[model samples]
Target: MKKIREIESLLGLPSPSNISVWWNMGSLLGFILVLQLVTGFLLSFHYTADLYCTFNSIIHIMRDVPGGWFLRSMHANGASFFFLLMYIHIGRGIYYQSYMMQPRTWMVGVTIFLVSMGTAFLGYVLPWGQMSYWGATVITNLMSAIPYFGTNLVEWVWGGFSVGQPTLNRFYSLHFLLPFVLSVLVMLHLVFLHEKGSTNPLGSLHHVAKIPFHPYFTIKDIVGVVLLSFIMLGIVFFGPNLFTDPENFIEANPMMTPVHIQPEWYFLYAYAILRSIPSKLGGVLALVFAVTYLYFFPVTMRMNVLPMAYSPISQFFFWQFVVVFGLLTWLGACPVEDPYVNIAPYLTVMYFALPILMQVSNSIWYKLIIS
Candidate 1:
């Protein structure tokens, strides 16, 4: 009880004041994480990790168990919502200079995100459906791009020449274990957050505007969670397949590839990069490095302080960059033939060139503002 009181007291300190509804994204993410875990636990009861039985087990759960259909639908669609909320949360962090003030918090949050992506990838392959199998094959094969030991490592991980039952079992095991690891990371993230306290919109340091976290932010978080849950349930009940690929409905057959083998929507950005380049090895390297490169943004950008806002030109470029990213996602879902292959390079370039453009625009804007 004493320890609890002490912790509460620390979190209750008055620091965050100008926080808006946008700040609720992190809390909302936490809520979605809990929801996913609960629903996933239920689904796992009926799921078999074996390739032969996995898809059948999923069907059994959907058709036989009472209210099982809703559970499975919610779990599947919930992943989409999870990524949506996470992107917004990460975007909010970027916009508000949160990372600048709380570097450790930002780094920890990024780490959690990367781990979550890995877990999602593993879970995606567990169904042993057509897309799951081919997606696993395509992604895992990228490891072969490594300089010397790549092919050997990929074979070792797959436990064969290609994705098979061994890969399915291994993925399932890691999928089950990763959420617990994510929970631990979330705890560490919160610890770091509590250390520095929350940042607000005004970007002030005087501690002028502050409120207790419990009654104020806690209630807000609850309201956000409730709203999100209502929307999620609506999707689960009405449009469960809206976010899923139709190709995944087919059973896995290694010999017969789907006309279009794409990953889950969350991975479309990286997938686009992988398909954009001409060389398989180059595409593989680009995809792997693209994400890992984000860690260097702070140092590479060389900005001592973060920008509060960008110039109109930079803002326009940023939105265009977003559109280009969406286009790449669409391309990723399409067959890797004409128009897609041709446009992939253009989209890929725009995807990476945005940050450079932002840096230039920032420099010009700051110079003009100071002058």
Candidate 2:
């Protein structure tokens, strides 16, 4: 009875009444995380981590494992949905200055994002396809750009001098394990969010009416889930391979690298940043910094009122950052030569520059509003 009451109290906590559809993303992400866990657990029963068997095992799952294709498709597409919702969730946070208000929550959220990417990268290698093998090789090789310990670190991660059976086994194990870690981090994120409370579309709502989360916000989450489900089901049944790379269909052959090696869509922005730099070590550092820079937002955009809500200048810069992000994603997929190559370095500059610009603009606006 005590536990039940606690659960009720948690769910029934007062949330700002004016919060909008954007606020519902957190609940939707929770749903997708559970869905991915269930589907991945089921898919693991028939999977083999051996390099020679990994590719064929995936085929066997599709052909023989009774509804295995559905499971595989759901798991695969769920990952895409996971990243999509997460990206939107992160973007919503930035637009609302949620990070500035709830610094601890934002920090945990960014760590979750980084860990989720690592988990996804590991999962990407499990299919043992051409892209899978070479993608693993390319990304793992980035660690070798570190100072003296670089080569040893890469070899240790590979379990040998090259990506092979040990690499597959290691990736498979870590991929299976990381989601559970993600689940815990998510719970921690919620704890911090509930502690600090949610940031509404408005800057602050100290005097506003607070509503229970159960019926009001839960309904919005349900609507989001239903809409997301329709899109996911459509892709799973009608176009399972819609987001898959063509190179991944071929079995992994270390001897033959794809003409154009690219990661899944979500990593494209960072990948573009990685490619734009001429130095190997610099590219790796830039890629790490690209995401980690979010950590500095609490310091950069610190202010009492919501930083972005009333500031049109800040809003303009935010949208420009979004455009730069999208352009970089597109450029990440293009062939790494001319026109495209020339455009990426410029976009990379804008990608890092725009956030600082938003901070400056918001700081000025806050001063004017106070005056």
Number of the top TM-score candidate: 2
Record all residue pairs in model 1 with backbone atoms less than 3 Å apart, i.e. clashing.
none
**Predicted candidate 2 versus true structure: per-residue lDDT over 171-247, tens digit per residue:** 99999999999999999999998875777787563636788889888888898999989999999999999999999
lDDT of 1 by residue, 168-257 (tens): 889988988899899999989988887768888644435666788878888888899889989998898788999887878888898998
Candidate 1's error at 137, in angstroms?
0.9
Q: State every prediction's TM-score relative to the real structure.
A: 0.93, 0.98
lDDT measured at residue 72 in model 1 versus the true structure, 0 to 100: 87
TM-score for candidate 2, residues paired by index: 0.98
Worst 10 residues of 1 by lDDT: 301-310
TM-score of 1: 0.93
- As a whole number from 0 to 100, the lDDT of residue 221 in candidate 2 is 84
